[model samples]
Target: DFTLEELKSLRVKQRYSFRDQQYNGKFSIITFEEFISIALDAPRVVGIYPEIKNPVFINQRVKWSNGKKFEDIFVETLKKYGYEGSYLSKKWLKQPAFIQSFAPTSLTYISNQTDLPKIFLIDDTTIPTQDTNQSFWEITSDHYLDYIKEYVVGIGPWKDNLVTASNNYLQTPTDLVARAHAHNFQVHPYTFRNENQFLHFNFSEDPYNEYDYWIKKIGVDGLFTDFTGSLHRYQEWTSPFLSSEKDAYNLLDKIVAMIFKVQAHLVLFFT
Candidate 1:
């Protein structure tokens, strides 16, 4: 197990074959605090979505003082950043954050520490839960959703799991989103990208189209896209921002039109 300093010394590289490798090793692994700081410093309000990644293995390898587990460290870092509040509360909306993890036990343990919304990530259907040794089918079952919903506000499933695809083409869509909504839980699927290889054939190689399909058609609560700018642009275009300036201009136009009509009425009455 590498200490935090040792881990920082290592450079990060692209893991996916489809991803650009030119910038490999150009970036270093960042501490959780650094990640939080980056979000806090953004020009606009930016929410942080951090994962308690691989808690089982990390706890097994990393040694901590006072016998604290990885989840403890993760949550402590969040609290240090002033990320406390229940989901959508006034405090939460100002500094939004969501704690995500694939490990159920870790989520449950940390739930007591912080009330920040948590998302239970669902892997591919073939995979099983790392901590509970439960299959995807078992976890996605309605009975399980009922129980897990108590801990998590939502589930982040693989995009493919929501819609069956074969030969890079989308097939029938699943009822997972409907089921999730029925349980009063949000569904935020992950890893959307602009790359052609990553795009399904049905989307015709356009990331915007993919976003439209998910946001408009599938009706997901949120997305985990690699191209945040692309998603932001799409959302802005589809639901254009009504700025205060625009609202003022619209009001001014209505006032001018009303004055013109009233003036015309006075002229007609005199004639």
Candidate 2:
């Protein structure tokens, strides 16, 4: 079995056709510490959403000292980066983060290690869970959400499953979002891209329209977009940041209107 250091020596590449491949082989596989450092060093309060991808396979292949499993090392790395707190807590809001995984068992295993929010990723309806071997139907059921909600704050489902598509045209959305909301669980859909090839016909090949549809119509709590800047801009333009500058502008406008009214009243009184 290859060690972690050996794995880091290998170059990272794009495995999917839809993703950008221009930088393939330019970057080596980064360690968890390196990845965490990138997020922590960002100028803004950027949140890290690292996935414990393919836990079963990772555990079978990778070995650690003290017989630590993959989940153990994963949580340990986050703890080292001070990523421990329940959702929306002061510590979490300061350095927001979410641990995601397709394998339910991996999430369950790490539940006690960190109180950080976890997102259970749901695959296609035909696929089964990587670790538990549970069918998509079984895992997405109301009963399952009830059980899993204890461990996870939200779900990250394949976007198409939430709104089924045929021939690249979106069909009626399923009740997954509503059902998840009913369970007090946030639904964050995945893999929103800006490319025309990825956009549906209903959106007229507009990424903004897709964002509007998902954020406004679908009422999703969060989105997993490939272009974070696109999502950020969309949110900023649609929902302006409620900063002190904005509040000051609003107060200034109110004061100007009040002064105008007083001036008009004085003009009438003088006349």
Candidate 3:
């Protein structure tokens, strides 16, 4: 409803009524550039994962001067900040990012512009894709995964869809994760919260237990949680890496070796 300048005047507040309101109205709303700046200023290498929310709706309502859709401006903004490279490339690792969107067309459109990895987001089983009008089941099919894998490096589905629940208790987990992995696509499920309301009874209402089940049991590549601190602690405790300079160098050595192996293969193929 408001322009960027007008939106900045508004203060952010907790969305859920159950949460504390102490910081409400204390901080002003910020632009996407400000969000990216925070990541760039971090002490360690921090990656940004920005979502293209409701592209179809936004394009319908907003008009750009050059007749560009919302996605063009979004990619241009990232380019303006010098963010361009394929996933895990030296340039990308320095300022890593994954552009995620539920719209397959938008992702394919941007694939022509940027090589930054994209993740396809899947909604509930009852919901159809915003752009493709494909059902959740159809999209998760082996055939569909094969097609989409060309554009997206991963899929971020609603966690419940990965592991169904009945009466607030988990049911037999689905093989979607296995199928996605078979296609060499990363499986990153979303919306893991610490609150009991979001937990299944199988987790004993413990967030760590939930994390263990998804990460260790289900073997997911990544997670989207409302509590980043909790997730960080769980990951640090479960998968601690040696912080010594020698260990760091050893890790980099292996990475360089892998890169050389890949380059050697490329040379062989071209020769």
Candidate 4:
């Protein structure tokens, strides 16, 4: 394996053939500190959602002179960058962040170190938990949700797991979102994309339809989308604020038309 310095020398490339490839070698890999800086420097209040991926594997291969676990290092970096506070707290709204991980043990350990909201990531049904070795069914059970609710503010599950599909057609959605809501936990499903392959047939190959089903029908708290622009457009098209703004503009146009008609009548009368 290459060191961080060696890794930075490599350029980024698109994984899928359908996606844009023009900028494949345009950018190099960025360090975690650089990632944090990008978020901090954004004009708007953009929240950072960093994942503690493969903690079991990372902890085994990586070592520190200070004798800290992978989770400790991760939390220290966040704290160092002033990413502390519960969900929607004043400090959080100023520089919001969510610490996510697939390993339950890592999340639990980090809870003692920082108050930043955490999300428990769920994998495919067939995959077992990397740390606890718990089956998907076991971890998603109401009993497990009850236990995990104390540590994490939400769960980020694989979208297909929440609503299964066969032959690319969507089936009935599971009650995971409802159950999560019942436990006062937010549910944010993952990796929404605009590409046809990533979309289910029920959406008629339209990303907006998929967004409608998930946002309106499924009632998820939020979505983790690959194409942020498409998601932003979808939200704007469906936003109540946009509707109200349109109504205000329409009212102003009608008033201006009435004024012009009245002035024309006055001119004719005076002439």
lDDT of each: 0.91, 0.92, 0.92, 0.93
State which candidate, 3 or 4, has the greater TM-score: 4
Expressed as tens digits, the lDDT of each residue in 35-62 for candidate 2 is 8889889998988999999989989987
Over 1-271, each residue of candidate 1 has an lDDT whose tens digit, in order, gives 5678898889988888777899888888987788888999999999989888999998998889999998988888888879989999998999999989999999899889999999999999999999999999999999999999889999999999999899999998999999999999989999898999799999888999999999889999999988989988887677645455567889999999999999999999999
Per-residue lDDT for 130 in model 4? 95
Query: Which scores better on TM-score, 1 or 4?
Result: 4
Q: At residue 78, what lDDT does model 2 achieve?
A: 87
Which run of 10 residues does model 4 get worst, by summed lDDT? 58-67
lDDT: worst 10-residue window of model 3: 237-246
Give stretches of model 3 more than 4 Å off. Answer: 240-271
List model 3 lDDT by residue over 1-271, tens digit each. 6788888888999998787889999999878999999988889988999999999999999999989999999999999887989988998988899999999999999998899999999999999999879999899999999899889999999998999999999999999999999999888999999998899999898999999999999999999989999999887677656346557899999999999999999999999
TM-scores for all candidates: the values are 0.87, 0.86, 0.87, 0.90
lDDT for model 4, on a 0 to 1 scale?
0.93
Candidate 1 Cα misplacement greater than 4 A, ranges: 16-22, 240-271
- Candidate number that wins on lDDT, 1 or 3: 3
Clash count in backbone of candidate 2: 0
The candidate that achieves the highest lDDT relative to the unseen native structure: 4
